[model samples]
Target: MPSIAYILSAIGIAAGITFILRLIPFGIKSILKDNKLIADLAAWIPMGAILILGVYVMAEIDYSSTTTALPYLIAAVVTVLVHSWRKNIALSLLIGTATCVVLANWVF
Candidate 1:
């Protein structure tokens, strides 16, 4: 059997490593804040992710079936319109998601 000191030491080591790993990102964030590349990445990454996701979603739609594609098309249109009009990301996303859900469940 392992001694109590050995187990305690193992636990302490694990906890210290966990804490340090979690802290490293925060420490680096300040250093990266002024970096032009990181700043550009921060601005573009979400847009890239959204674009990728939109492409993936569109690819899943059945082009032959109007019924299958209609809800997604409508929801995407509403999302863009809402975002353009209100300039609120959360509201646009909520409205878009709700539109998709309602149309998919009831209309489509």
Candidate 2:
């Protein structure tokens, strides 16, 4: 088991590094206000960040056991299909989770 002090120290270090990195872009924007290229690139940063996170989540899935993943896979697929059909994220998520629970027990 990990110690609380080590966990807190790691968390603090991570937060501090992230905060400093975030400030770099803002500082650059101020210094290069007249550069349209820099501004245009910065505009796509959010989309790039989202794409990176999405890929990370997808890539991190454990495929070694179907038992744990099947439910989540079913839920995600149901969520997408329901959202596509009904155009309601909240309803889709709720129904997806219910379907996943039912399917999990039914299949596995």
RMSD of each: 1.9, 8.9
How far residue 106's Cα lies from its native spot in candidate 2, in Å, is 4.0
Q: What residue runs in model 1 are displaced by over 4 Å at the alpha carbon?
A: 1-7
For every model shown, what is its TM-score relative to the native structure? 0.85, 0.42
Tens-place lDDT per residue, model 1, 1-108, is 999999999999999999999999999998888899998999899879888988899889987988888999999999999999999878998999899999988998
Whole-model Cα lDDT of every candidate shown, in order: 0.92, 0.80
State the lDDT at 52 in candidate 2: 81
Collision pairs in model 1: none
Error of 2 at 99 (Å): 1.5
- Worst lDDT run of 10 residues, candidate 1, spans 46-55
Which candidate leads the pack in TM-score? 1
lDDT of the structure predicted as candidate 1:
0.92
Clash total of candidate 2 = 0
Q: How does model 1 score by TM-score?
A: 0.85
